[model samples]
Target chain A: MKFFRNLTIGQYVHKDSPIHKLDPRIKILTSLLMMILIFLTESWWSFLIIGFFFTVNIWLSKVQIKYVLRGLKPILVLIILTLFIHLFTTPGEVIFQIGVIRMTWEGLSRGMFIAVRLFLLILTTSWLTLTTSPIALTDGIERLLSFFKIIGFPAHEIAMMMTIALRFIPTLMEETEKIIKAQMSRGADFESGNILKRMKNMIPIIIPLFINAFHRADELAIAMEARCYRGGEGRTHYRALSFKYLDKVFFMIISFTIALIIIINVV
Target chain B: MFIYLENASYTYNLNMPFETKALDSINLSIDRGEFIGIIGHTGCGKTTLLQLLNGLLEPTIGHVFIDGVDIHQNKKGLKEIRKKIGLTFQYPENQLFEESIYKEIAFGPRNLGITDDLLDERVKKAMKMVELDYNQYKDRSPFELSGGEMRRVAIASVLAIDPEIIILDEPTASLDPQSHASFLTLIKNLYQKYHKTMILVSHNMDVIAELAQRVLVMEKGKIIMDSTPRNIFQESVEQLEKIGLELPQVTYVMHRLKQMGKEVNSGVLTIEEAKEEIFSILKVKKSNNEIF
Candidate 1:
């Protein structure tokens, strides 16, 4: 079995849609604003509006709907359990009683609302990752954090670390698979047994994984040094960020939608 | 028989968006005391096939029988099958983790429940087989060793299990010529001395020609040819070329010489064999010209 879950984190689905082509910085800022609005507003009707906005964004991103749904698979059980607990345990105007359990209409509504909020949050974030490439995301973060350079925040260093970490995710995953196979061949059984036995079995696999990661880190540092990489100083990018008219238009539409959601909630 | 794959087919990320059929309907039986070589281009399912032999991966479609028992059927005792078959991965030295070289080699035997005297003996024997001195390297950290030494320690770790079948995937990859030759010699000696069944996966024609009696050629996810190395290199050269596998340098030279009307044998694989054949041919020609 593969160690790394196929969760599709930081994965970009290459597409030539308008949403995909918009500057990543614009998309990043807009999504952040939308997420904050989602958490700020408490009204249910406003959430429906937010949900509609996300659905449109998902459509514009042109990523496969099936893939986006697959990314939501892991949270399904958690959401269901959460809803069940909230519905049965909350003591309000008890509409039904079943052997020391009380159920209320208010609890049911609140549980449904919480579940919807979670679903919308996950879907929107997944849409962001699907449309934006990792490199572009790092670039956006670095540019936005450049404002903190005045306060000695080491923004460039942080961005470089993030980019490298993202880059090595796949490599380390492949290495982990290899090490697991190696240990397995040596009679290291990781799947069977109780929790303690299984955890004890992971010792061999984890030790080797850590060792290989350190080895790779050392080699990567040497290679980077040999190539004269010095903390992103005096560096020029191959692809420069240029804001297009569409980026401005997309930003305006997102801001307007957030404003409308807020106004609707307040009224 | 040591290991067998019966109509085994494996697909990566099965039933997912990224699903890929890595192996397709592969049926092969590896007998004890036999050396088999597997050669293929990149992404030709060579590594996937190797993982199947050791039960690191279960076949999606069929059974993997190690010593005539289906391994997947008994999930709890599958560890025993793993102990019986040792698989050394490509660039396996990267997985070195033990603080000392001795402990690293002892890892496998210890996993098999060998204790004290037998454990020490197994470790020493494995180190000796890989030509690493016990006293000189037993306590040293594996990370501090040279690249070639680290590779040997990795192989020794597998050897400590004393498996009936040893599968090495590209054991000599990324080594200097001298180290490569020495590694090949060590593998050859292991085969001769222990008579353990070996499944060697490599793209190096010279190593395969010297070690394997039988060779399986893979292209994509299918086994294209399975025959003796001599027959494969002699008869299937064109097909192998089409699949992007180059012949050994000596074999290429031998083929060129035959094409140029020289009476050199096409099956000459090693440089020494080619040298002897060319010298004998020249000697015979010189005597005939002197008679004329």
Candidate 2:
């Protein structure tokens, strides 16, 4: 129960490091490019190169390596499960056999590639999220999507939704823990019950949490309307995103590295 | 001692970078049928102490005993202890999920294996204790009630279990003045008529002065002062003020009289006591005037 308070996922870490100071639009764009490069990566050389890039980016962001790795914990089981499945199922040169469970050479290589790819994908996105605040992220996303407005994209509404969701994650978690404790005080056994019983016990907690969430949503809407919040039409931002000299330098560096990686892959 | 904590301490997120010591070696003994008030600032471990008492959280260091038995020693025993100690959280109405108030208040007792006619009786008794008419409000959805009625229903849910001890955390925090006064009266009646050991946690000094037999003052995760309400208000006014705790309003009035060169006792707690002290001084002045 105490762990609920510590259930912090990869949220923004406020710091004045170089990465945090860069334009969030550039960060989002580079992160997108990095995802592409990660998918195209099939060799250890490319992975090694990209891994080095992530190390440098994380260092520049002033975030500890351990904190970034902690985000990988929830997915570690999935990664390992995939690796084991690949080890047993992929048909190739047999490394060994344990009662018809054929361990293949290609399977080993493929599993390693997939594992490293997923790991780097998580690392890159977490890097972007950790360095940029939600407000900045929402602003950057809206600006980027505003380019697609000719396709009838509701850029403002989508950005507002993302911002609200990100804002309430922590608040919701606190409320959840409080509801659980309140129920527990009334002798509701959340711990020792079987699956069905445990789930049934959760009704006491979930119902109240939902009621409170809906109440909060209603109040927030009223509050926003009271403040005369119209749609994103003709609305300006408090933080007007600007591309600066430093942004140009980082942009060029990232573009050059990604270009070099693409050329190597093609050749 | 019916309920006792022996050097209980709680540290959240142990071995993590953001670990916090919420309670620091609290040793306290509370007898049965005792009405105790715990006062502290918002993050001063009062709620944590309440949770520890009812076995919602296990103490990281010490032990909590209910009737000479360690509640945490066995799962079966802990549930029984929970039956003996009912806890109502602040805005407890949020936990109400049943379609009707009857099912809502019956939730606790039903969980304890009371059912059929026994369950019906318990629900009716609990509703009556909160001053809600059983037949009128039992079938209504808890969500449809006003804020104060919903709270009374919430408190009734705890009372359904018939726990000898009831722990409330800021039970009257956001109530209207009328509801607040009535709520206090209800609590006083619950304690006096039913002999329930009431452990109330509130920052409202006047409420504590009126209701609590003893006061426990907390600061920085420690129990710094434990005394009768009048003694705590009279003797520790300066110390409490230094720690940013507000004493009862009437204590200040009495203290003001003492500071104005009047021979006034400076430790009155409630409005009634303050009025009596003032009238005594005025009556003596009139008698002296008649003699002259």
Candidate 3:
């Protein structure tokens, strides 16, 4: 029934904070660097460092811990699967045996380590999206991708598509809820069905949603045309992005964190 | 006592940072076979109230009792309650999906586990109810029909359920004049023929004036006024105007004449009544001039 409420992923939480004020390009770059750091780090101490960095970023972003945690709800199964896979399968010194299944210390540590890494990786990207508005995020992506324009890359087009997609997420979700409610009013029980039955039930919701989306797209294309919206060529922005001192400071802090993680890995 | 909202309140995204109280604690009731129209400004919680009425949304506080029992108390009976009150969303055309009109209209009865001949009967009945010829439009793609036809098909899909109370949210919105009039007529026929408890939500004062026996005016998540449509459109002209709701054309004309110091009844509900009121005054003037 509630689709938009728990939708924290790629949703910008408007809050008065330094992270909110930082340039989107800097935030995007730093998020990317932290993701690489999360992948590279091996030692448990490195995880603690990355975890601390994420906790601080979440705090600075001014989004609630609970809101950020909700973003992981969809992937909770995958995280648990990774942890269990390592625990049951990784060969190591057996701490105990349950009918040919060994509970090894190495397996447990490895599982915990991998789980933490995956969690931190998700936290990094979500933090960027949470703090930065979708428009700014697209602008950042466009600016970063503009470098490839030398090879005739469609950076602006790509960014525009991403911007539209992100902007429509909540709208589409709300429409989806309406369709479900409308169907439910017709005695359509979406819940309490076998998986295949539930999936088949989705046909009623999906076709409407897809058709509505196409209708909206067609209308939007005409609207843009009526407004004389050409491609991104020679287009200027309404909100000109400027990398201020705050963004520079934030950039340096993240760079320093990344260097520290890299040095820790080398050691 | 048929359907009641006792101190019901609904808050969207409850406890979240973006939480909003869409409905304040309010008490209301609807009798059987009553045609009630709910009108309000945008974001005034009209849709939210409709959702609460049909149990699509559970009130954050208080209860929605249907037939003297709280509907939310038994989760299993929600579908039954839904079957009792059909809610047709605004732009119901967006909910139509089946490849053929037959399957689309049959969706509701089919969901209730009705099958084969029984389902076909319901679909045919619904199609006929909407004035869409069953034999002509049954096998045709709902998507291929015109906007108004698609709208009717969508509504037929809901009517196929044969709910005791049918709730329409902005039924006449975004329709051409012909379709709007025809749609209103269709609703009127349903009320007269079936005696279903008809609940319609529309911002159009004319629609409310024409149909609703009782009108509920909502503001800021609370039902501010519950009165007959005539009383609401006439007695509360200034207040309704202040709230940015336009009175019906006839009501507005009558009110305007009254404001101009004319001897006319400002409480007229229809154009015919307004015309008679104005003619009465003209007759008085003509007789006065003759005496002079």
Candidate 4:
């Protein structure tokens, strides 16, 4: 019933910490590079190195670990399912057997590794959102994607759309919560229903949500057009993105972490 | 103290960087059938208080009791309490999603396990209570209705559950003049007809002055004034204004008359009442041989 309240997407917790001060482009790129390294990692030591960097970044972000972990709650089931898939599907020396299910030492290790990797991935991404405002994130994305303009990718528009979507997450959640409560007051039971019944029950909420969303989008488009929003073409930003000295230091730390991850994989 | 709040407080995003204390240590009580008006500036926690009443949001501290039972303590009872305390939120029309108006109104009572036989009767009855034509609009899509009609459908949806306590937050907001007047009249009629305990939260002092027997003024998540409308409006004009709230238009006129050295009753709410007070004063002055 209270699932959406703990939502972390597009939630920016304002802080004056170094992580919050880092250029959002650097944060985005560093996290992307770290994500690549995490997927490439083969050894436990590499995980430890990446984990150390993740933990340090989280600490520097000055966001509560509990708040960051709350974002992982929705993905907890995904992580568990991935672990079990790895544990049972991989072929290796069997260490335990129960009925049709067999567990191998290698499978167990691999499953554990995958679980850790998924957990770290979610953490890193959540940290990026927590430390950076949506405006900065959008600006950073637009700048990063600007390089693809040569290929004719409407980068500014895509970035703006993402930014709008992110900005509306909290508004939509608030709306949904209100709708749920309004329905609940009239004895609408969203919790206890069969799968189909639950989905059927959601019609009252989803329909209104969509209608309202469309209405809001229509209004927004009109407002934007009224304000002469020409979709980033010849558009200047109010707060320009500039990399400070700390952004360089942050890049160096993330590069070092990547190097360590590479060395651990090679050795 | 039929409905009681014991030092109740609510904070959003607890322990997070953006945590905010929406309601702060609020303690108040409402009798079974009292019409209570809650007035506050925007973001003053009026809506949060309404949500807490029906157990939509639990208090971060203290307890909210309905009929002497702590609602949050028992899961089964909380659902029952929620059924009894029906809340029609601000911009209620946006909550409508059912294909037909009948199903939309029936959604509430159906959730309470009312038999299908009773549901048709209840929905029809609730629609009638809101002055909507059950036979005409029942099969019609809710989205096809005008804004005011859609709002009534939403309110009827809440009313179908036969809640003993009805809470409305800014019910007349964003309505046309004619629609707002009728909407308030409909609410007033429903309250009188059912004798339901009603809690109305609004920024319109005139509406609150007209409808509410008792008024609760909130500021910074606290109940700064809780008194009868007459008492709160008549004497606390300056204080209320300081909190960014104004007196009802007629009451403001009375305050102005009093400042102009005319002996006008400051407690007058409606324009009719103001007229009566002014006439009475004029009659007295004429009998005393006062010059015009």
Candidate 5:
């Protein structure tokens, strides 16, 4: 009961490895390139190539295979459901039939291809998150988006918001747990009710969570002001990012992979 | 008897890869008017244990009985049990959602189906219990109040239901000393005035020492010690230290004095008692000096 609901987003596991040491900008670009290539490839063989590269990269990251798999577990049901729907419901020549249910070879292959693509996409994105700290990620994003500032885009503000939101994920999770325990002690029955009743019971928990979240936001704003935070205008980073030789090599490999996938699809 | 957990144990995310045993097999009973202090380090199952007592969590291996009936046995009875045992979580101010403090306090009683005059009376009484002035604060939005005031309003919201037992989990966490002291006094008044059974889960030894008649110490999902506060602090100082808990300041001072060859009892828990003991020792030393 205490463990199932502790799912937190953007939690980076600290480790000393090649992937962890890579420049955040390179990782971000690699992730984006992989996502683009994944969408570009329509053939099965290219997926195999991409999957092979993904497996090797994950292995090199030195993260426990189990932790990456754990992140995948939450999305497994969605992937399976999507595959089943795509395989059986798409109109095509019947490869197999069971009463009203019919399966087509094309649909089956497409389903498998889509599932694998989605799986790799999620896994690669998770790898980026697992390896890079949130601060570094946002810093890279802010720097990348700074180009848009010339066109009147509020890139710095957006980046600041993202960083703060990411920073509060764990704090808010801990607070939510405390609030739930408090309401539970008050005899709020959240577990054993019909859908409506359960939702009704959640009023106690959700209300408190929102209240606390806002309270925290207010306090954070004041604290920031007290510390002379003037919204990313004159801010200097504690750790300025520098791209190394490994970053260059990593980006070059990603570019090569994308080119190969695109060339295969075109041919 | 109001609540009873018979040989209960709870594990979080059972059968999952991240499974953890939050509470071990334990037996506990709370009468209608008893105040129980549950003390433990972080992750020691104090919060889990509180959830069990109020039937927010059904025991994985045992049953929770409220008013001589198992709460999980029937839906109607479970609702009643929830109404009977009101829990105020630590930093409860987060739960305030209504537009006004009055409505926030009235929320619980309304859920329990009380109406009209009785609801108003309960709201007013609950506000008074927490030392909130109904006239000044009731019409105000809870969101506008300071952290301490919002916390009191949150507690008032729960008290409106007139629960027989109240459970507070680290009620004074992160508050200034003045606010903490005032909040403690408010809770003490609730115990004395209404005689409601209270279970306070806290890591603050001073709060527990001042409030709890009986203390339950938990470590690694097990109740390591359950006794009167005096007994637990005096008899198991070494064990408590091993579990990352410290005795109250007065008790620590008394223990140090005893170690330094002074004729002083180490069981004293409050500053007032320590003052009397130190004064007597000083007088004795002065008399010896004159005789010399």
Candidate 6:
């Protein structure tokens, strides 16, 4: 019955903790580094190291473990697909065979490795988003992308769009909840339908939602123009992003973790 | 049917960091054919209370009984309970999505399995109730209508279901004065002619005074006052002002006159009642002056 309740993308849970207090740039860079290193991980011991660090970071973040796990539910299908693809196709010593399908130790191990890697990758990225507000994340992204502006990248514009879209997620979610309740009151059965039937039922919801979204977009454009929102050539942020000593310390800790992970993979 | 909420409470985003208690220890009952008005400031759980009456939400702490039977005891018949108590939400026009007005109004009864001849009859009957011509407008798209007309169509959609009790959440919101008066009259007819147990949640004290026999004033979460409109308006001007609500225009005038040394009853809810009260008080004052 809850349509957008499980959606966690662009959701920021406010908590006053070290991870939440970390510089958004440092948190973004650390997440990117972890994503790359997780793919480079080839052994179960490496996953154990990554998983341990992840669990500790999550604990330090002060967000509920159950809430973080709920964000993982949407990607379960992808994880299962990756696991099965690795499990059945990889060439290895056969442990069991039925006709052309073979179960192998290598396949099982590779499947587990890929599953853990994907899980950790998703977990770290979501953790980055969970700890940082959308405005701060966009600021971090814009700052990082400014280096590429010499190559004619529209970094500020992109960052602004991203921030605006992220800001609308909760608003749109509330609107969708309203529309769903409206339809439900009219005896529109969103649940208890087959796949096709359910999609048909969703038509009642999706059309009105699109109309409202377009209307909102028009109103927002007018409001922005009224405020004289020109492109961000010389626009300065009200709350400027500055790197404090704590940001430097956070960067050092992440660099040390990355170095340890690389050494584990190489050795 | 009797509707009772016993010590009911609700918390949004329960068990999450953003959890909020919207309703708190609300205990109220409505007998059949009673016109009840619920008034409160924004976010004071007036909408939440309306949703609870028809089972749109379940209380986190207490039970909601419809005809002395707990509707949530068996989830199997919950839909049946919903159909029996029609709920037209605020800005109901947003619910219109069918291709034609005919199909739009028929959506509810069709879901209830009324098909063939009875469906047409119900759709036409509902449309006529809202003053829309079935022959001319049935094939027209609901989106093509004016805002006020579309609002009526959305309401007609709910009426097609023909429930025993109808709950409207601010039905006249955002309408012009002319349309607002007509809409209230339409609701009045529905209440008087059909004897349906109507529960209206409105911010307009005048509308509540004009229609509701019983008024339930909500503050924060609980019902602070539940009594006749006369009793509620006559005495609670100061308390209502403290809660960010104002008395009806007529009542406010009478209240001001009473403060200015006139022996006027401050519970007048309409312009006509205020005029009669003023005239009676003026006549009595003249006779006393002549005797002196």
Q: Per-residue lDDT of B1-292 in model 5, one digit per residue for the tens?
A: 6677888999987787678999889888777777889888999998888878766687889888887898888856766877877887666776666788888888778867789999989999998899888799879999889889988888888898898888888899999989988988888988997788888988899888888999999998888888999999999999999989999999999999999999998998878889999999999999999998
Q: Runs in model 1 with CA error above 4 Å?
A: A1-7, A76-92, A97-101, A265-267, B259-261, B285-292
Report the Cα lDDT for residue A120, model 3.
Answer: 88
The Cα local distance difference test for each model comes to: 0.87, 0.89, 0.88, 0.88, 0.84, 0.87
* lDDT (10s digit) by residue, model 1, range A20-115: 888988878877887787777789888888888878888887898987888788899988888888898777888889889889988898788788
Each model's total of backbone clashes: 0, 0, 0, 1, 4, 0
Off by over 4 Å in 3: A1-4, A15-18, A41-94, A97-99, A105-116, A241-267, B282-292
Q: Model 6 — TM-score against the truth?
A: 0.88
TM-score per model (chain B): 0.97, 0.98, 0.95, 0.95, 0.96, 0.95
If both were scored by lDDT, which would come out higher, candidate 5 or candidate 6? 6
True contacts kept of each: 0.60, 0.75, 0.85, 0.81, 0.50, 0.52
Where model 2 places Cα greater than 4 Å from the true spot, the runs are: A1-3, A41-45, B258-264, B285-292
lDDT of each residue in A149-180, candidate 5, tens digit only: 89988888999999889888878887777767
Error of 5 at A95 (Å): 5.6
**Tens-digit lDDT track of model 2 for B46-156:** 988999988889999999998998888886677788899999988898888999999999888988899999999999999988999999999999999999999999999
**Which regions of candidate 4 are displaced past 4 Å?**
A1-3, A11-133, A242-267, B15-18, B115-117, B284-292
Per-residue accuracy of model 4 over B1-292 as CA lDDT, tens digit each? 7789999999988897689999999999988889999999899999999988998889999999999999999876767997788899999999998899998898888778887779899998999989998789999999999999999999999999888888999999999999999988898987898788999999899999999999999999999999999999978878998989988999878888899999988899987788899999989988889553
Best by lDDT: 2
Q: Predictions ranked by DockQ, top down? A: 3, 2, 4, 1, 6, 5
| Per-model TM-score versus the true fold | 0.90, 0.93, 0.90, 0.84, 0.77, 0.88
Looking at model 3 chain B, which ten-residue stretch has the lowest summed lDDT? Answer: B266-275
Where is model 6 more than 4 Å wrong at Cα?
A1-19, A40-105, A148-152, A249-267, B281-292
Quality of model 4 by C-alpha lDDT = 0.88
lDDT of 3 by residue, B1-292 (tens): 7999999999998886679999999899999989999998999999999898888899999999999989988999898898888899899998988999999999899888899999989998999899999889999999999889999999999899999899999999999999998998899998998788899999888888889999999989998889998788777877887878888888878878889999888878876787799899999999999998
TM-score-wise, the better of 1 and 4 is 1
List the candidate numbers ranked by TM-score, top first. 2, 1, 3, 6, 4, 5
Lowest-scoring 10 consecutive residues by lDDT in candidate 1 chain A? A1-10
Residue-by-residue lDDT tens digits, candidate 3, A1-267? 554566554667789998889888888888888788788778877788888987998897788887688777778899999998899888898888999788888889999999988898888877988888888889999999999999999999999999889888878998989988888888888888899999998998999999999999999899999999888899999888898999788778887887888888898
